[model samples]
Target: MTYTFTCKKVPLSDSVKEYAQKRIDKLGRYFQDDPAVHVSFSVEREVLCAVEITIRSGSTILRSQSQAVDGDMRGAIDSGVAYIERQILKNKTRLAKRLRSEGFPSVVEDVSFAVKEEAEFDIVRTKHVPVKPMTAEEAILQMNLIGHGFFIFRNASDNAVSIVYRRNNGGYGLILADDME
Candidate 1:
């Protein structure tokens, strides 16, 4: 696995970088192969150190972030690496569930989990008279009525797609995708 280390507001040390790279490289033990990990270290408020680790393979992404108050940068890096490893384990359980649901054929030498792909087309489905604006509560009701997991509607305030969907806790969750230039 390849590791990329980037530092901000702090001088990069060879020892610190090597320690982080070696620590996260252990993630390969849980799976058949390891995915490349990206580590970003930054200093906020010139005192607290922040590290963000992102492991990506194709369409799948696993990320974890942590911060520490130690003056030593190596301590923060170690904490971040531990956080990332824990996150990967959590993701492994999720992958196991998906494999059980969709069926796992074989465990190859590479990343053992299979990635599912989905595509959406932008065409006319069932046209409506007017795209009415409503609150997230209304969207949840409409989604339940249509027997769909999610319902997208224009927010009366921002005119954006604010989605409401069923959660495993028997409650609804709202997704508000932001629009940025």
Candidate 2:
């Protein structure tokens, strides 16, 4: 497995890298084959310690981003590790439910449980709307005018299909769709 660390805006010392490496190795037991792991540490305006870990195994991806309580990198790494572990555990539970009627006696050492959920979404209604070209602001405005959570439209800037949604906390989020190679 390859572990890559990206330090943004702050020069991470050797001690910090060593600390992060240990934390990352703790999660390595979950992968069967070599997986690509990317860890990024950054400092944002509101967030003191910004640590994000992304693990890519085959076609599956597990990511966790954590912020420390008081700009503590170790604490942030710990929290991120815990969060990703929980995610893995959750996926394992779901996969186990489908794999066997009875649960496993020990903790699973595989992370591919998240590869295929196998579960299907309950779809009751489907709608087809005309995708008109518009700017991000216009999409947000359309979403608000319709009192909908999200609005889908073609982007005027790039002519790509995009979605704009109202975030739970605040502000709006734009999702741009790209072609698959």
Clash pairs (backbone) in predicted model 2: none
Q: lDDT per residue, candidate 2, 1-181, as tens digits?
A: 6889999987888898899888878766666667798999988774588899998875557899998756698999988888877766666655344333243336446544333333555799999999999999998989999999999999999899999999865899999997653
Q: Which candidate achieves the best TM-score against the true structure?
A: 2
| lDDT on C-alpha atoms for all candidate structures | 0.68, 0.79
Cα lDDT tens digits for candidate 1, 4-99: 888788787797788887777765554444567898888888888888888765445667777888656677767666665445444444554422
Count of clashes, each model: 0, 0
TM-score of 1: 0.51
Stretches off by above 4 angstroms in model 1 are: 97-181
lDDT score of residue 95 within candidate 1: 55
What TM-score, computed on C-alpha atoms, does each candidate reach? 0.51, 0.67
Q: Tell me model 1's lDDT, rounded to 2 decimals.
A: 0.68
RMSD in Å for all candidates: 11.3, 5.8
